[model samples]
Target: METMLITGANRGLGLEWVRQLDAAGWRVHATYRDPAKAEGLFAIAKKSHGRVVPHQLDVTDFTAIDRLSVTLKDEAIDVLNNNAGILPARKKFGQTDYDEWARIMRNNLFSYMKMAEAFVEQIARSRRKMILCMTSGLSSLSAAGSRGTASKFGDGKHVYRTTKCAVNMLAINLAGYLAERGVIALSVTPGWANTEMGRADLDPGYSPDDLVDPVKSVEGMRRIIATATIEDSGRLMRWDGSTLPF
Candidate 1:
């Protein structure tokens, strides 16, 4: 069976990916931070009949990551889906929170690199050797300016955008290193999906109605992953398999 290890499977697009992949008969090692925040994930696991296994993971915790790596040491992780991230509050040019900015960078950017460093051997041993980073269109120099309406989103989220951009670069850099091991490491933007983080109050954006379906976006991403080859690595791609600029 094709297997995947996806972090941040508690809610939003992360939760959606868990549901879709579990339905498609893929074995999923789904991780979430808080059990209290994971009711939906636990419910899905209950119905998954052993196909979906849930692990408690805080990607920002390197010690926790190492422990999980030891726990799953013998298991083959085909895809390491780095999907855990935090949504930033609106911050104007002068209002950037340096502390919070650093926190987001650790959560969104460094954790991905740490996960790869820990689980790369498992990925190398898998049948479909791949590592997928969940990036954003905001990471792109050419694409960010055109993504969402400025009126709704305003000029904020500098930290979130910066982390995504850095993670994209990290994924590309890993591709170069892992290529010798036959691993395809690529980053993909899940688009502006109608998830909790993608809605108003999070960043004062549109309602769920204005965003793309999370399920549909994940479905497209699955297709992209299933067909991805080494040639596709080191590129920033959309859920629809289109390229995004760095």
Candidate 2:
């Protein structure tokens, strides 16, 4: 069975991914900032028997990441999904909170690099080397300016958008570096899903069944990660399984 590691598994999209992947017979190493707060996940793991294991990880901590790396050193991780991210509560550009901005960048972008860097050797050992970075459509310069649907989230949070934009470049650069080694590093937008940070009235017109529910989205992402080939590396993809503009 293929093994995978997911961050922010306590709630929202991360928890759903754990459920779907566990059901599919994948060995899931799901991390939460505090395992004590992951009651919901613990309940789900009870049902999964032993396929899922809860991990305590604060992605910003390099020491913790390195420690986890050593613990799972023997396991070959097929996919590393950097799904944990933060949305700014306030949206004014000049009125930004430096601490909040720093936190978002740490969790959304920097931690991804740290995790991949620390675990690259483990991923390299896997038969199918894949890394999935979850991104937002709001992060796209084209989508942000074109008024092509993603513009609904008005500007002001320069910090959040900038961090995601950085993630795009990070994926591209990493893909280039890993290309020769047969590793696939790709960025994907999960569409406008109804997560805790999303607004109430903003709907993508996708049905509840069709919408990017966290559980369904993870399954879709797993399939995409599984099918990745040299030809598909370095591309930006959507949850609908199509390439998106950088």
Top TM-score model: 1
Prediction 2 TM-score vs. true: 0.89
Give candidate 1 misplaced runs (Cα > 4 Å). Answer: 148-154, 201-205
lDDT of each residue in 152-210, candidate 1, tens digit only:
33367678888998988999899999999999999998887888777743335546676
Model 2, residue 202: distance off in Å is 5.1
Q: Which portions of model 2 show Cα errors greater than 4 Å?
A: 145-154, 199-211
Give one digit per residue, the lDDT tens place, for model 2 in 148-193: 5535455565777789889988988889988887778988877656
Top-lDDT structure, candidate number: 1
